[model samples]
Target: MFEIKDNHLAAGDLLAEALAKVPGIRHVKEVNDLSDIDKPTATPCLFYLYYGDQLTDAANAGANMQLKQTWLVVLAERKGSKQAGTNITATIRAIAGKMTGGAGPWQRVNTPIKPKYTNGHAFYPLAFTCQMRFKGALK
Candidate 1:
């Protein structure tokens, strides 16, 4: 998942498009339901990645790049439990690399709070943290 200024689904969608190269990512989904009392306020922007073997393939392709701090969400299916953690971390790094075109002196903005995972039972989701700086409205 890509971090957008607003934390909205649109941003997540855009991120999905930008990260189209990732393999095994069967699909990207926007989750807006906040019924969980423990759930944090939904960022105006966010996306969840549904990954598979293809995701591994895609991540391996981008392993050789340098990426700056970036936000991402990795959702592994129940069956793919074995590789969930590693795949998520690697995929985020790969997406960040691809988004920045493998080169960046991107200014970093430390998030006041660390991004974390929620709905731990089956989803196995993890959120990302990245430094953000802004001068204009993020599209």
Candidate 2:
């Protein structure tokens, strides 16, 4: 068995900081912070990240020592529904660009699907996933 200790916290922090640069964004929160909020505020905009999973490749012996970690990113803009999709999609694209250009700490292993608007929500919400590879010691 192998244990992979990926820098998920650090990665999420960096990603959030990057997103905070988007204009009108009042909230750059983590899932942990969301959990503590009894009543969420109608902030101008908000984004949060949740840790996903770490899975290793069992087929390859070498791959067993490493794992792929994923994060679920949620974006919401309460000000304008029409502009919500555009805002979230642009932010996602910016994150992707950072990965390809080596602007971030971890390698972005996967690309998020195009962001779309959702119904039945007070804010225009979009969800996406980000993946990163993590190496660990083999035993």
Candidate 3:
């Protein structure tokens, strides 16, 4: 018998666990949108936003299917502090060092974009990609 697993959720769980270990990470969670987060008790919060997923390959009859899922790791910090920029940069490097180029489910996609400032908050968006396989139907 074959079973289909919730790989997306699994990936998110793995991400949360890994991100929790990075120093200076105050909060980590999966959010539908970046605006969903209000004022956190701590700075340098990390949010996981599911971007999208696509079928990587067409599955023949009884063959497994492959999917590529993309996610965004947004690092948010309150602006105005002198160490704001340095803190963001250090946290970004820590996250990259811990999450990238490992046997993890996700891989860093590209360079993080410039910070976006809004309402005294600065957000740095980093992209990541993951591959998952769905088992074929049982005969």
Query: Which stretches of model 3 miss by more than 4 angstroms?
Result: 1-7, 80-105, 111-114
Order of candidate numbers by TM-score, starting with the best: 3, 2, 1
Q: Every model's Cα RMSD, please?
A: 13.3, 5.8, 4.3
TM accuracy, model 1 = 0.40
Which TM-score value belongs to model 3?
Answer: 0.72
Question: Which ranges of candidate 1 are over 4 A from the true structure?
Answer: 1-10, 34-72, 97-121, 129-139
User: Which has the better TM-score: candidate 1, or candidate 2?
Assistant: 2
List clashing residue pairs in candidate 1: 7-43, 7-44, 7-45, 8-44, 8-45, 23-54, 23-55, 24-54, 24-55, 109-131
lDDT of 3: 0.65
Write down the lDDT of every candidate, Cα atoms only.
Answer: 0.38, 0.50, 0.65
Clashes of 3: 0
Give all TM-scores, in the order shown. 0.40, 0.57, 0.72
> Which candidate do you rate higher for lDDT, 1 or 2?
2
| Candidate 3: residue pairs that collide | none
The weakest ten consecutive residues by lDDT in model 2 span 100-109
> What's the TM for model 2?
0.57
- State the lDDT of candidate 2 residue by residue for 37-127, as single tens digits: 2234654456565545555454345544334445555555443456766666666665653642222433344434443333433333344
